[model samples]
Target: MVNLGDLNNDIPFDVLSRLPTKYMPKLKCVSKGWNRLISDPTFMKVQSQKREQLSGFFFQQKYQWCYDDITTISYIPVEKQDAELHKTVFNFLPEHVVVLASCNGLLCCRSCFPFHDSCLYICNPLSNEWLRLKWDEPNKENSFALAFDPCQDPIATPTNFKLIRVKQFETDKEALCFSFEIYSSDKGAWRKSEEICKCNNNLYKNRGIFTEGVLHWLTDGDEVLTFNVENELSWLVSVPIPANEFRSIPESCIGDSDGRLHYILVSEYGLQVWFLEDYFESRWSLKLCKTLEEMEEEHSQFLYNLRERVTQRLAVDMEPWIDPLAFKDGPLFCFTIATFHAHFSILEENLCSKFLTSCTQTSSLLHGKAIHAKFIKGSIPHSLYLQNHILNMYVKCGDLINGHKLFDEMPERNVVSWSAMVSGFTQHRFYNEALSLFVYMLRDGTSRPNEFTFVSVLQACSLHESLALAYQVYAVVLRLGFGSNVFLVNAFLTALMRHGEKEEAFEVFEKCLNKDIVTWNVMLSGYLESSCLELPKFWVQMNNEGVKPDCFTFASVLTGLASLGELNMGLQAHGQIVKSGHGGEICVGNSLVDMYIKSQRLFDGLKEKEEMAVQKKQAEVRPVGTLVQF
Candidate 1:
């Protein structure tokens, strides 16, 4: 994207691209020649990606435009070293501006002017990479957000991503869609995302988020739209929002934390959050933060619940550091400043000893046992009796070195120790190291491996792409017993598919009588990603086995069919999809449309797309869908 800039912007893009599209709307605001340039699709795409990256990262209400001396600002999450939160500086110098949205760790900012054209930029403050995107004319009123299109599964990386600015007309009744663009690193041109803007006669805000290859936002009328970068299609979705929230709060923006879509609804008193759950019939659950009036009761409840989690996390009666639930859901990104700093400080305090010493120790280290005796020798067995108290402490304090040291010194090892070691490795992505230890425990008389061990080993094998060892470990599991355990079997399937063994993988799966949805997904992915000779047969087998092919089953099978260019067989599957009512799922519909398009069935593709459109409208327009209110 950086290769060619418009003749106006002194960027390398103009000089680099075979044919550059430049000096569009922003230049058009300057002259008619520039306006003509803005009309081209290529220019729109590049500028949009760039703008999306910079135009929105994170913005707090700088309520007033106070373009005055803004000196010495340290970001909250970063400056305080909040473990779960993110912090980065604004790359551009202390020039005052307001941030709109941030996508893919890039931020966009607007200057102090009320009506004039505001500046746009894509910046990674941590990396100090900044690209300034210019816009044409004044943006007096616009409903937009910064969106990064990292096509998770790319057919091919498009020329660029886009910044979608929903331009409202005189009244809220209509809106026009314009985009600021980014240049694709892989594709050397600007690309366009043909997203349509939704209009309503009510106040709207931009809560656009970059997730799953789309930019999603709740519209002014409380509807949702998702923009797909690969196909450049803007699709409407029915985002769940609570009825009371819209009535109580004037407007809100969208944000994602910990893989869940969240909308921050602020009122006179404080901020409330609605967590959008995509599963369980697409509903939003509300969580209220504690205010002064509610603090005592909430605090009492929190402590009551916290005590239970601590006991579960810690086993023995040692003082609990972090509540066990805090680590549940795999470390939430929600914590106050004081709580986070305390957590970090606790980590540092625990790291002062030999356990800390081992972690930062070079790969070629000496006296492994000597180090263990040096820091935590005598008091450990007592610590172990304390229900893995010290282990939890080590895990929490981020003192894995000490945790491992304590772990190794134990008189007898339990399932938790091995699991912890494996988990630590998995978390850090040292898959081979984790798998080696898992094997060592199973075969080398170090520790007794359990079902959890098998799960961890299979997962590590998947990550390492260790097909040979994965099969061997599968054998070990069968010999050790618990071969038919569904969870372990699912992990085995996942590992096999990851290692590219689909047929034998299915053979292994057939032995596991207890079937679950996850197991089916792994089996299905083999057919989805690669054409195994037996996929059509397996698709039929999955149905015979009383395993209803969900949208995922159809999606994966369709992929294998598409790869083989089996249009006739593909049509047969499509007929099954219709009979099975799988066409209603958004995921299945998307895959179906793509398959149809590839098979030169535009009519079918359009028909599936229309179903998605209908689903979106029905979900978003009105929960009850009636013109009159009782």
Candidate 2:
């Protein structure tokens, strides 16, 4: 194999730039030269430009009936090539991010759980490069828009970007008005923009279109709201067509297409597309007009072509109505269709799988249910992998009713499917249910219990304090030749110890050849809790085995020694903790303080307590503007 660095830098640059951005992070390990090449900000920008494409529209739908305002944001890709791109687009971000705005491939996102002051982050999902904005006024509810134009100079290192925050305030006359706060990347701080645009009509807060260094938003009134980022000025232009008298509200939106502004209007008859021919003259020209029948016919043809390529049949029960969302380059238009039951999207099987995994990881029940509904409506064949993922999502999200329902409805079951449900039941404290499912899994004879399956069942037994059930499970484990398996032995030992069968737990521990830190900790904790006199002997044996003690071990030993008023043993444990580098841990410190106090060393205990308090204070006073690189 040839080294990437051995060739000219341009050769490697061209090859690496063409690869997908998701795979770029892993390529850093190829060589130091490759790492440096990929780390360059200029190379990342070029790669982002090549790999990032406007494939979809992300829209938020609000469910008013929910007690808390629940907004479901989803993406619908326009082209087939970008169908799977949405799965990993925002996965690199640390927290759940609500996409506030998008401009030139950079997404302005705010943390879903804004527990801190700096919740806003401007990120390029393609390259996984992000910058957190210093947001001091987190308490104030403000609408934000992003404006990013790539640097024109070839030698420029940093890209220049701007963020516009609009806050609504009440005037002395009790009329609503908006004020502007602008943050520029070059200045690295936020400044108040003197210009303020006042409008009584409620502006669409979430949606903003950025083009030609200007951001636009549609207002309730028949006007277009505009903000120029460079000059920090706000203005309004009259709409091409005013709201009709009969219709109290009109379905209209604004978008940028090929560097020019375009307006779309939906009426009972059909849809009309208008282009802003001249911004200075405020001139408008009708670009395209279509009747409702014509639009439906085109949609039907598109769906028909899609159906031909798909082997599965489409659902015939639901009627979906489409709403045009935005216009892209050429004839590409992004739209969203909603049925009576759920929103519809043509998600590929793998994409559905990824969405289910994300939902499971986040415990997002609502999103999981929506994806399941879409899967059913799309009539995709349920592979065992997808079915297991869906089941796991439901179970992990604590929706056991739906999880069991889906499990029962599944045509086939595998060991993974059984293990997930069993684990879910045990995790949610449904001990009896978990045991019953384990028994049923055995009776079904389709799948056999693996180590993971046994782990959950043993945990359920231990938590339920069912020694008889644990014995039976252990017999099965022995028969399956897993008696020496360290994990199974540990679980077995835990069950025995929890039921006060220390002798049996010790016997199991002695027979196991491979023991990890957890095994030692489990035995040591059980002995300490039961006041077993063999604790000292066991600790010496652990040291003889060359197994290092961690914070938990030191804490347990210190607590036991303190209870018995053994100051010498406690002091020895403290020295071990210090040598092991666990003395600074909060748990270890608390243990040491307790041990010192119980031994009548009042001065030492108070000194340790004061040290802990000072350390915590210093941690709390640390600066918050530290840059976090992903």
Candidate 3:
């Protein structure tokens, strides 16, 4: 047997690069040589090129409420493996982080706190590393776009990244002038560019697309704002389509495919895809055009009652609207249909499993129902995986009645089907039903409970206040080799704490090998909720472990301090909160106010309250059109 050491380094390098990126970290532990090979910049670039094609797209949707608007970023993948890998790409970031833009494998995120100074973070989810940008001018409502091309630099470094911030300024003549402030990782600071572009129409602040060393933003007029990152020049290119054909709200978007710029136009007629055949010559080529009737005929089952639903909303004057989102390398396009309710749909050759999963993830009940109707009519092929997705969609959309009926009618049940139903029941407060389903699943022996199944069942046990059942489930979890799942362990700890089993919960916590921030928060909050005098001791232990506290942790600790009237400790905690950049979190702010008021610092408390009120009013008054609401 020849040792790897005897083989050429290229042999090992080529073999390792073929493995999934998720396993790279573990492979680094094999030896120092392997670690160095994997850590090399060149090796990373090669591996990235060898990796799979563009897996999916991350899109943001804003939901407007009476007081404020909440923006959420969601990922939809084209393949199941990609879904499992990239769905939680941003979960590792702090809560309330809004993704500003993405290029290559990097994401630019901003803190979404209304009152505090905004912070920007550039992170690589695959590598689980992030860097915070120095952004002092948080009050400026400027647009930002990220540009990074892996092929540009052989030796990749942070300096290879560029962030462009566009701020609109008015001249004495009242013309709309936009200035560019660029942040280069190499320079380690932001510099003002002398290039200024004047336009008659406003550019969409958040909708910037970077492709081929050029950053493009769609303008309110019939032009696109193109900025060359290398030359630091700005110009506008006329949209390929006629100006009058565009809608007032601008349903068209610019996307990049195969290193060429493509413009997507959404109109009452249908969707048109135009490619820039020659950027220099300003030549455009019509690649694909589908009429509304053609689209409806092709996706009739999916858009079954879309027109009827829009008619019911009395938007008879308004035609069915489609918003172009993202365009991939091939013919695939991602977009949303608005028929009173927004439904996400992918225009692909076939309604694949990934599309069904996307609908389930977005809770698009109407689309899911249409697909199910197609399944019933034998128009679409039936599979256990697709059926489970539909069931999950109904359950997530709060149609539990339909969800249960579908579950019962399923020709066969798998682990996913059972787990989805169980989670649904628990989520909708049917704890008894969840417990019953768990028992039935075990008795049937068709499938065994996995980590997810245990999590949901444990939650049900805790909410049902059935400690005995929780203990039984815990035993089964351990026997089934799922004793190491952190999520399952967290749920078990919660169950124990809810029943006043503090000592037992502590034991479980200590036994947990991998304690994430969530684990520590659970223990801290549990102690506070129990009014246990050991709260301070537990807090000290958590600090000793060097677990960074988040907004939730700060909120819990401050609440306990307030109840105990520990003003001095509360002050120190408040300083830490600010230092950690969680000062803008509404939960933390509210807790700060509570602590100050409880400690008789009425002036400070009142000041915080007033500031929060002002911020709330600002958010409420902001124009809805400026927001990217679904």
Candidate 4:
């Protein structure tokens, strides 16, 4: 055995003495002295020089940024009026540079090049060591954007950062193409990939955002494209688009939903995002957001600009979203890389809870139309937002089933009071009840349906197909200037189609400016129902617009064609189906047989295909490898 005297000072820990305690018992007998050193709480604690080994020490607050200046005008949610937070300013930033986010217990900051110089530096906050990220080729008139996710795992050998830097060189200045790359400290390398972009669209006037676990940016045609940090891959998808602009500028193009690679597109629409159900697939189906225009039109207040005020008012109720259980368990929750471990009661959640409780209780306690006026009489209680939160919870819980009694008994019924009723019915699937309240809301005509109000009404009408009712809704929808909303147009079209008013449905379909695949499907189905047999031509239109048809589109068209008794066309479609490897899809195959049978093309052919499908399904479920081996 090596003597402890021979050990160097740099290796400070007692490796030999601790070795037996850490890894012995398998080799030989251990004495009580060695056992005590390993088992003694104080010795073990001092031996491992890591900070905060216990989980319940500190709580973290989350902040979101949407603009260019990281220095001035940063907005963070304050848990309380007296709540305080620390800010670490990186003065080492070269002039125009700024920091984006702190991820994985490490800090990431980016410095922009001055006057289109195109040179940029990205750094790790913990190391103070930065990299002069090399562009594939340099350009003087070029511009750059950068992001850093600092979260790291101390227990692991090394940590990971979501490092993405994009450089766009002006073609006029001398560049054939645009290039971007993501960096990984764990692998100690960078990989090259191209974003999903339109080859013939504008690349210079580009916008970028960094959040979750990737760098997200919008393309010319308004597609949301992202570069993944962990897998080093890129992806593109269509997100929800709002009809009207915030200040006539599209708010959909703002940034990534929440940075840790989570898709915030639905949340951006102002929906009550329940659970990120399947965040990995980037599949987000939210409790629909009622946009500002939908709200305005619903209450016959179609001619107003209430989006900003309504948004501000709606935001107050959701503040401080931390879990309440955290308060009793831990001193603080650590949030790194956008994931929280150990729960710290966020001051914000408490604030949000109080806001909800206050909005309702004060209304119960006061009798005037203006609750604000009463608060004005005295200092506005700290409990106002909490009262509003309680009202919202009551509404969501459908406790508003007793709302009529509650409203009559209420000290006052202001806008929020009516809103609570409208929201309550909608949340509880009391659509007719919700609609009745809308009529009542407009009876006196003082209160108007704001953004949140209208979206609920429009969604309620989507499944109910009453053309006259929809047209009336449309008159208001357009009067509120929501004619541009792709989603609402869907509701408008569905109403017409159900009433067999194919002509009117087609009119609105053609007028939509932002046509995604869903829009195309609606139009294609309408054209087919009207026997405008040239359905495939619309696929050309979709292709020309650069919208890719998924397998669902194929299923929709094939079902339509089979219904038309077009055997030759069906045969051609079958060829396309087989070519696209969708021949065996259940809907496609079933529709193919149904089409053939209806067309009287060949009855035997249909039966044989069904048998083959059944055989295939059976084969898929019963593995051949499971059979006994000789």
Candidate 5:
């Protein structure tokens, strides 16, 4: 290799800009002259342009091993003749990591395991830099899309980005409308956009395709929901043809090519690509409509090799398989027989019901009803096990009418069936119905209440602040020898406290056998709710018990400190929260802000009154519907 330093200044900018970005760190170590050349502002701009022009695609492959599933990302370049796929595996990421959207070179991901709508991270795998963002918006029925403009500066380092989340709020009359919350990196906070758009609740799987300065969603109908990232406005554009005129839109998908919007349709003929030739005119030009026969003829050799490889993998069960999706990258998209088999099995004998139950997570009542009709008409047998699952599906899909109807129709009911109905009722805020069902189940005496049953009933009690009923439930728990059960006791304490029975709540908390972190959090939340000034003592006891403080613990303590206007205690707690790596949490940050504005040293009583007014205004600006409910 030629000496980089000797030719550094003389080297053509084109050649230097064409080099991969990963090589920059290594080249910077060659010599000072080379380092200066690579780091130059002009050279950086050229490099950023080259990087943007480079064609590549990113996708994830999931493999299930026993009970655990691992997802690996692959990046494939289109221009290179023989490019090796770049793989990224983040071990620290949650088991159920979902790629929400990609903007520039940064991937926006959310961790869905252990907790849904838990945390989001914006990461650049090339730079190995990532930041966890506190998502303070209500994530219910929400769709998140990431948009970044790199017109001036294309390098995917820390820069200004706007993350848009659209959430659907359904009215009692079944009318669907949406509200938006936009998170600006500049603001370092999420703001509720005043724009609310009316639309059908037919979003395609929490995914949106970003193109040209807007994010687009292909609904079940002919309408394309478009949200302008810059202006924070949303509008619907009609498709050239009605969705029903062609194949089912549910099976179709929307994507982006270059900077224009594209709709992909997979039909019996083959893959047809439609490009939007004019955004305002809503004119679409047919790009490619390759027949399956032509595709098969072209990919015959590759298909043969793929078949051989899949056969070998199935024979040994040790050989790894890869399913490449190079849709927008180039014409290298490939799928293996193993993938087909995994998908085809979804309609098989035993798996179809399970798939229906899993689809409940989508909260699509219409889809659930369709599947229910299929189950009734299909080859699947109608067993009690399947009935319980159907009941659960209806409940989870928010179809309580059908859920109750099916529950009452069950000729032979078990504990699972009753628990499913009760839990569903409790989840939908049907507290009276849930409690009445629990009582009915007990009076029947055939199916006994399980842990889930007790938890659901306790939630209902807590909702209505039913202290007398809570005591009665506690008596039943004691008689059933479940008084020592940590889960039941925790729920009981929550119910008691919500009913203003603070003394009884503490008595129950102290009588608990094994106090876990959740137990402590419940007690802390109870104390904070009651305005009890014994949090300091409780912290001492918690430390004595060797239980480390978690985010919830710190949030509760901070709430207490803020309430009392104890700036010293608040400062100490804030220090611990930052040290514990929860400083970025929205709740914690809000508490700190309240504590600061209320600090006795910072403001006199009159000043405090003024600050409180300002704080209240800020708080009013942040509506409850904007943040994750949990």
Candidate 6:
């Protein structure tokens, strides 16, 4: 057994080149000869030739400014066993850096500022080395892109790259045209490309897919704008959309997977993926067609089992009853609706409806509404199930008027129907209506209010000065023996604090037997609202109890320190933020900026003002939870 590090130049080049890319950087630091061998241009070419599969994908997480934070560059390996590679973070680049493109192992980043002369940087994340390319062009705003192909080039250099920026505006002829400035790494200067292509400037930006030695930008009109980096030519390739439900190109997403161009059509029935089989002939082949139902499991057996369990608990006699004509003015229909409601209680557990509801709630609101209309035109039993989910989707989408209307017209109601209406109202800020509906549901006594119902009701109570109402709900929770439940207790504590009942909130917090991260965060946030001095003690106690803090915890703690002007404490917390890998988080970044600025004002007197300015710029990009004041 021989140590690889101890091996001399007598070793074969094939064996030396077979070592992992990650090891190369560390091995470079081993010895002068080893470093030279690893760093040689010929050795790098050999390594590239031997590499079969892609190592991983390089992606950046947007915070505020485009800075090269260690947390920014992420390497996601295709193999799960190489999960350790995902933890490697590269942060050598300057702040306010936006990743334009990545080819081979090289990444190109530029300043994200609106319209200022900015430099573009090309870097190898594996080596953590960068080369800054000066782009001192005019200050007018331009959309930029990076294109490179190491495999296609006969001769490859580390500096082989093409930076293309398009300045698009209407010409004197009143037709849209593009002016391009191309920068070749080989040429080392910017030059205007003679090829002028007509495109919608307003709709075009740099979301180009690099494949087949070409950078492809799918235009708004389904035309692929192609630019060959090697040949330095620009042309258009028309991508003919299949005449189907998705009438426009916007309904489809263009992607490059494994060096092949792919078009993904998000149709109503399912997702259709087409690969460009022949680019010149404009030939495409259907690669995969996966329907939503096939992708999701049918929850019929689980739903039936859940229904039976609920029916056994609620029914006077523990026996099954089935009737097709149950909904037509009969007690059987009433029983059926009760059973249906039980299944709906665990609606989040139902895979099919949950998937469909998520789709509707997030992006496809119009698509969901159309599907609901189609479901309404179908048979009865299936329609009941569909109606329940549709009701949830409408409520989730902020269509409370329609949600309430649907609830009112239902002949029979269950806990799910009632809870959906109450939750929707609470989410949409219709607090009064949500509270009123909860009371009505309790009075109806048809179904017992679950944890979700109580949580939603408590949330509504917290928003208003309804301290008495919240106490009433708390009493009900105690009567139902759910007062010890951590979730409900947290909601109860939050509600108490919201109504300026800090003393009562503390009482609730002290009684929480199982205090999770949210429990600690909620109590800390409440204390911060009043500038309570007990935050430090609570933070120490949280640590002693072995509770690891998250982004929210740090944000609240940093905010408290910022307000109290505790510079030393804030710095300590900032270190913790970095250690926890939440330094780039939007909320945490805000508090850091505020804390630093305040600390500087007290001692250094704006010495770190430029750094603060960069942070503030980053804060502007990441706007969520940035309410910390100077």
Candidate 2 clashes between residue pairs 3 or more apart in a chain or in different chains: none
User: Model 5: which residue pairs collide?
Assistant: 137-626, 137-627, 137-628, 138-626, 138-627
In terms of lDDT, the best-performing candidate is 3
Q: Write the per-residue lDDT of candidate 1 for residues 559-596, one digit (tens) a residue.
A: 77776677787788888888998777777777778888
**Top candidate, metric TM-score:** 2
- Cα lDDT tens digits for candidate 2, 121-146: 89875457898876675642567888
lDDT head-to-head 1 vs 4, winner = 1
Where is the poorest 10-residue window by lDDT in model 1?
621-630
Q: Which runs of model 1 end up more than 4 angstroms from their true locations?
A: 1-301, 304-413, 440-446, 463-465, 497-503, 528-532, 565-587, 606-630
Supply the TM-score for candidate 5.
0.47
> What does candidate 6's lDDT look like per residue over 569-608, in tens digits?
7778777777887866767766776677766653433433
Candidate 5 lDDT at 270 equals 54
Candidate 5 residue 405 C-alpha distance from true site, Å: 2.5
lDDT of 2 at 449: 96
TM-score of each: 0.39, 0.54, 0.49, 0.35, 0.47, 0.45
How well is each residue in 46-138 modelled by candidate 5, as lDDT tens digits?
A: 675452444555645454435343454555555553455544434444444656777666678766432434678876655556777876642
Q: Give the whole-model CA lDDT for all candidates, comma-separated.
A: 0.54, 0.72, 0.73, 0.48, 0.67, 0.64
Q: State the weakest 10-residue window (summed lDDT) of model 4.
A: 329-338
Question: For residues 266-295, what per-residue lDDT tens digits would candidate 4 score against the true structure?
Answer: 122342332233334645455335654663
RMSD of 3: 20.9
Sequence-dependent TM-score of model 6: 0.45
Error of 4 at 340 (Å): 13
Q: In angstroms, give how far residue 51 of model 4 lies from its true place.
A: 29
Against the hidden true structure, what lDDT does model 5 obtain?
0.67
Can you tell me which runs of candidate 6 are displaced by over 4 Å?
1-355, 379-383, 600-630
